[model samples]
Target chain A: MITIKKPGLLSTIQDLGRYGYQKYGVVVSGVMDSFSFRIANLLVGNEENTPAIEMTIVGPSIQFHQDSLIAICGGDLSPSIDGQTISMWRPIFVKKDSTLQFGESINGARAYLAVAGGIVVPYVMGSASTYVRGKLGGLLGRALQSGDQVEIGNLTELSKKVMDHLHTNGPAKWFVPFYKPINPIIRMLKGHEFDLFTDASKNLLINETFTITKEADRMGYRLSGPKLMQKEQKDMLSAAVSLGTIQITPDGSPIILLADRQTTGGYPKIAQVISVDLPLLAQMKPMDQVRFQMVTLEEAQHLFRKNETYLTDIKRAIKLKYR
Target chain B: MDLQFYPLGDQAVILEFGNIINPTIHKQIQVVSNYIEENPPDWMIEFTTAFTTITVFYNPEVLFYKEVCQELSHLLKNIKWDEPNEYRMIEIPVCYGGDFGPDLIEVAKTNGLTTDEVIDIHAKGEYIVYMIGFAPGFPYLGGMSEKIATPRKATPRLKIPARSVGIAGTQTGVYPIETPGGWQLIGKTPLELFLPNQEVPSLLRAGDRVHFTPISLDQYMEMEQTRS
Candidate 1:
C-alpha cells in the first residue's frame, strides 16, 4: 500500500490509455509521456501498460506502507528517499514506512512512478487511466488526493523475482536509459490541410521556433510563433483527432492535441507530430521553444519500429539476467 | 467519385468522400463505415465518421502506411453503396417550452414566431445523426427546419443539463452530458442519450434517424421515474 502525504499540482494513475472507446467519444486519457511510462514499468519488471502514478510539473510526496520495489522515470523531478537523492531510471528497494518526496523538476515537465506490481484500480473500458473530465477510471475517477491510499496489484513472476533479488542486497548500479532527443525538434507528417496554409506559413512552421504558451495542459499545447492562415476560410466537419495532431485555430495559432484531447475536433489540422517524437513534445514545459521538422510516413514508421525493437531487446536482456 | 485518402498521423488515415455536408455525402460516409465495421481489418484499431469523411485509426506497428492506404482504396472500390438500412428510426419524447426549455421564448421572439410555432417547426423536422463528439454520446445532428434556426447564445452557460435538445445555427443536437454549451435549448428529452456501462454506450449512432415526439411534463417525470 502507498499513502500520498501531499498531492502535488496534478497527479493521477495512467497506463498506455483507454482504447476501443473513442468511437463512443470517450477521451483516451493516459500518461502524457507514454515512452517514460513504459520505461518506468520495464525497470520494475512490469508490463509496459502497467498502471503508474503520473506526476505533473510538481510531484507528490508519498509514503510506502509496505516493502516494495519501485522505479521513477521521465522528467527529473529531483526525487529523494529519506533526504537522499534517488536515481531516475533504476529500481530501488523501499522499506515499509519509508517516505519518498520530490523537489523542483530539473529537466522535464512530467514524471512516472512504477511499482513492481501495477496500481490496483478498477478498470473502466479496459484501462486504468484517469479521465477526469468524464470521471471514467483510476482511483474514484479523479486525481490522487493527499490522503489517498492506493493498493498495489498482485505481482507477476518477473516482478516477484525482481523484488526478491532487491531484498537480497542486489547490484546497486542497475539502470536503463530512456529515449532523449538531442535537439528540441519534433518531427511530423503533413496533415490533410497542410497545403491549405500559405507557403510562407509552411516554411515558418519548419524553420521558426514556437513557444509553448501558458494555456498548455494535458488537453493541448497552444503554441505561439507563426500566424498560419489558410488560403481559404472553410468550416471543416468535426473528425476523429488523436494525440500529437497540430490543429490551427481561426486565430491562426497552432495547438498540439495531447493525451486528454477531445476525441474529435473541427479545426483544420496542419501537421501531425510523429509517434516517435511524441515523447519530446510531452516533456516540453510552458515557455520552452521547439522547432518542427517534416518527415515522410515511411521515416516515421522506421523510427517507431526501431524504438519498439530496442524495447523488445531490453525486455529479453532483463529476462536473461533474472534467469 | 475520386476518394482522397490523407494521413491524419502515423496512426490514422482519413478517406474523404466530398467537400460539403449533404445527405449523399453522409450516406457515402456511412456505407464505408458500415462495410469496415462488418468486415474489420486486423490492423484497424477504430474508425469514426464526420460529415463527409471517415477517419480510420490503426496500429502502425502491425501494418505499414502504404499497405493500409492501398487496402482501403481496394476495399472502397468493391463496396456496394446501395444497401437496405438496418438502423431503426427512434422516437424521442421531448417536453418543449416552459421550464424545460429556457431559450424557447427567446428563440421564438428572435425568429419572429410564436412559441408554439417554433416548437411545431422543430418537432416536425426529420433529423439524422451525423456523428458523436464534443462530449460522450453528444450527437452532431443534421436536418433541422430553417424556420426554427437561430444563432447560438452570445455567452454560453457553464452548465447545460444532459438530455437537453438544442439548436445552434442550422444544426440540432442533444447534450448527452452536463457541459458548458452555447446552443439554444428549446426542449428536454426524457430518454438517456448516453449510457457509459453498456457495450454500446451511446443511445444513437451515425446514420440513425430520429424523430421528436412532444410530451407533457408529467409524461417526462413518469419516464424519468421508470428509468431510475
Candidate 2:
C-alpha cells in the first residue's frame, strides 16, 4: 500500500484504458505517453497495460506502507527515494516507511510510476482508467488527492524474485533505453473536411507551425497560428471523431483531438495526426510548437505497424535481460 | 446513390453518402455499417456510424489505402439499401417544467403559447433517434415540430444537468451527463439516459425511436431518491 502525502499537479491513476466503447461516447483516458508506460511496466515485470500513477509536471510524494519495488519512466523528472536522487529508467528497491518525492520535470510534462503489480483501482468499463469528465472510473473517478491510499495488486513471482535479488546486491547496472526523442513531425492524412478548405489552406497547414494553447488536455489541444477559411462547407453534421482528428471550428481555429475527445464532433476536420505521433501529443504542454506534414494513408499505416513491432522487440529485450 | 469514400486517418476510412440528412441516406449508412460489422477483414478493428456515413478502422498491414476504398466501393455498389427497421422502440418518462426545466417558460413565451400546450406538443411527438453523441448516450433527435423552434442560449452554461430535455435550432434531445451546453432546457428526466455501470448504458441508441411521457414532480423526486 502507498499513501499520497502530496497529490501534486494533475497526478491521476491510469492504465491502458477501455476500447470498443467509443460508440457509447467513452474516450480512452489511459497513459498519454504509452511508450514510457510500457517501459515502466517492463522494468518491474508488470503487464504492459497495468494501472499506474500518471504525474504531470509535478509528481507526488508517497509513503509506502510496505517494502516494494518501483520504476519511473516518461519525462526527465528528478525523482528521489528517501531524499536520495534516483535515475529515471532504472528500478529501485525501497524498504518500508521510505518517502518518495518527485521534483519538477527537466524535460517533458508527464512521468509514470509503475509498481511491482500495478496500482489496484476498482475497474470501470473493463479498465482501471480515469475519465474525469463524467466522473467515471479511477479512484472514485477523480485525480489523486492528498491522503489517498492505493493497494498494490497481486505481486508477480518474477517481481518477488527480482526484489530479493536486488536486496542482496543493488540496482541493475544498465537500464532499458527509452530512446532520446526526436523533434516532432506530425504526419497527417486528409480529413473528411479536408476538401472543404481552399488549396492554400491545405498548403499552409503542411508548411506552417501551430502552437498548443493552455486549453489542451487529454480531450484535445486547441491550437493557434493559421486561421484558414473553408471554401465550400459551412456546417457539418456530427460524425465519429477519434484520436489525432484535427478539427477546424467555425471561427477557423484548429483543435487536435486526443485520448479523451468526444466520440463525435460537428467541426470540419482538416487532417488527422497519424497514430504513431499521438503519444507525443499527450506530452505536449500549452504553447508547445508543432508542425504538420502530409503522409499518404499507406505510409501512415506502415509507420503504425513499424512502431508496434518496435514495442514488441523492446518488451522481449527487457524479459531477456532478467533471464 | 454512389458512396464517396475518404480517409479520416491512416487507420480509418469514411464512406460518405454525400452531405444530405434524409432518412434514405441514413438507412444507407446503417446498411454499410451492418455489413462491415458482420464481414470484417483481418485488420479491421471497429466501425462507428453517424448521419450519412460510416468510419472503419483497419490494420494497415493487411489492407492498403486503395484496397480499403475499393473493397468498400465494390460492396457498396452491390448492397441493398432498403430494409425493415433493425431496432426496437422505447418510451422515456420526463418531468417537464419547474425546477427540472428552468427555461420552459422562456421557450413557451417565445412560441406564444401556454406552458401546458408546449409540454403537450413535445410529449405527443414520437421522436426518431438520429444519432448518439455530444455526451454519452445523449441522443440527437429529429422530428421536433417548428412550434418549439427555439434558439440556443447565447452563453452556454458550464453545467447542464444530466437527463435534462433541451432544444436547440430545430433539434430536441436529452443531456446524458452534466456538460457545458447551449441547448435551451425545459425539463429533467428521472431516467438515466446513459449509465456507465450498466451494459449498453445509453437508454437511447441510434435508429431507436423514443417518445417522452410527462410524469408528476412527486414521481420524479421518488425516482431520484430510489436511485441514490
Candidate 3:
C-alpha cells in the first residue's frame, strides 16, 4: 500500500483507457503520454495496460508502506527519494516507509509512476482509467487527495522476478534514453476535411508555429496561431474523432484533441497528429510552442509500426535480463 | 448503399455512409454498427457511430492500414440488413417549468406559444434516438415538432444540471451529466440516463425510440426519491 502525502496539482490513475464505450458517448480518458506510461509499466515488469499514477506539472509526495519495485517515466518533475535524486526509465527498489517526492519542473509536463503489481482499483467498464468528467473509473472517479491510501494488486510472475532482482541489486545500471523536447514539430496526417480549408490556411498550418494557450488540459490544447479559414462554411454532421485530431473552432484557432476528448465532434478537423508524436504533444505544457509537419498515410503507418517494434524489442531485452 | 471510407488516423478509419443526415443513412450506420458489434474482428479495437458515419478504431500492430480497409470492406458485404429492426422504446418522465426548468418561459416565448402549449407539443411528439454523443448517455434525439424549435442561447451556461432536457434548433436531448451547453432548457427528467455502476453504463443506445411525458413536481419528487 502507498499513501499519498501530497496530491500535487492533478494526479489520477490511468491505464490504456476505457474501450468499448465510445458508442455511448463515453470519453476514452487515459494517460496523456502513452509511450512513457507503457515504458514505466514495462520497467516495473507490469503489463503495458496496467494502471499507473499519472501526475501533472506538480507530482505527488508518496509514502510506500511496503518494499516495492517502481519506475518513473515521462516528464521530469525532479523525483527524489530521501533527498537523493532518482534515475528514471529504470526499475528502482524502495524500502518500506520511504518517502518519494518531486520538486521543480525539469522537463516535460506529466509524469507516470508504475509499481511492480500496478495500482488496485475496481474496474468500471473493464478499465481502471479515470474519466473525471463522467465520474467513471479510477479512485472514486477523482484525482488523488492527501492521505489517500491506495492498495497494490498482486504481482505477476515477471513482476515478482523483477522485484527480487531489484532487491539484490539496488538499481539497474542501464536505462532507456527518452528524448524530452519543449518545442517539437508534431507530424500529422490529413484529416477528412483537410481539403476543405483555404490554400493559405493549409500553408500556414505547416509553416507557422502555434503556442499552446492557458486553456490546455487533459481534454485538449487550445492553440494560438495563425487563423485557419475554410473555403466555405459547411454544416458538418457530427462524426467520431480520434486521439490526435486537430479541430479548427469557429474562431479559427486549432484545438488538438487528446486523451479525454469527446468520442465525436461537429467541428471540421484539419489534421490528425501521427501516433508516434502524440506522446511528444502530451508532454507539452501550456505556453509551449509547436509546429506541424504533414506526413502521408503510408509514412504514418510505417512510423507507428516502427514504434511498436521498438517497444517489443525493449520488452524482450528486459525479459532476457531478468531471466 | 453507397459507402465511402476515409482514414481518421493511423489507427482508425471513418466509414461514411453519406454527407447528409437522414433516415436511410441512419439505418445504414445502424446496420453496420450492429454487425460489427456482433462480430468484431480481432484487429478491431472498438467503434463509434454518429449521424451518418461509423468510425472503426483498430490496432495498427495487428493489421496494416490497407489490410484494415480491406477487412472492413469485406465485412460490410456480410451485414444482415434484413434482420428485424428491434429498437427499444423508452418513455422519460419530465417536470417542466418552475426551478427545474429555468428557461421554460424563454423557450415558450421564442416559439410564440404558451408554456402549457409548448409542453403539450413536446410531450405529444414521438422522437427517435439518432446517436448518443457529446456527453455520456446524452441522447441526440430527432423527430421534434418544429413549432417549438428554438435557437441555441448566444452565451452557453457554464453548468447545465444533469438530467436537464433541452431543445436546440430542431433537435432535443437530455443531459445525462452536467456540462456547459447552449441548448435551451425546457424541462428536467427524473430518470438516470447514465448509470456508471451497471455493466452497460449508458441507459440509452443508438436506434432506440424515445418519448417524453410531462409530470407534476410532486410526481417528479416521488420518482426522484425512489431512484435515489
lDDT of 1 by residue, A6-90 (tens): 9998999999998777777888889899888888898788999999999998999999998888999998999999898999888
If the candidates were sorted by their lDDT against the true structure, best first, what order would they fall in?
A: 3, 1, 2
DockQ (Cα-based) for each candidate: 0.74, 0.66, 0.85
| Regions of model 2 farther than 4 Å from truth | B34-43, B59-80, B226-228
Interface RMSD of each: 1.0, 1.6, 0.9
What TM-score does candidate 3 reach?
0.98
Candidate 3 chain B weakest lDDT stretch, 10 residues? B79-88
Residue-pair clashes per candidate:
0, 1, 0
| Among all candidates shown, the one with the greatest lDDT | 3
**What stretches of model 3 exceed 4 Å from their correct place?**
B82-84
Candidate 3 lDDT, tens digit per residue, A115-204? Answer: 989999999988999988888799999999999999988888888898898788767899988887758899999998999999999999
- State the C-alpha lDDT per candidate: 0.88, 0.82, 0.91
Q: Which candidate gets the maximum TM-score versus the true structure?
A: 3
**Fraction of the real A/B interface contacts present in each candidate?**
0.63, 0.66, 0.87
Better of 1 and 3 by lDDT: 3
Q: By DockQ, highest first, what's the ranking?
A: 3, 1, 2
lDDT of 2 at B73: 72
- The candidate that wins on DockQ is 3
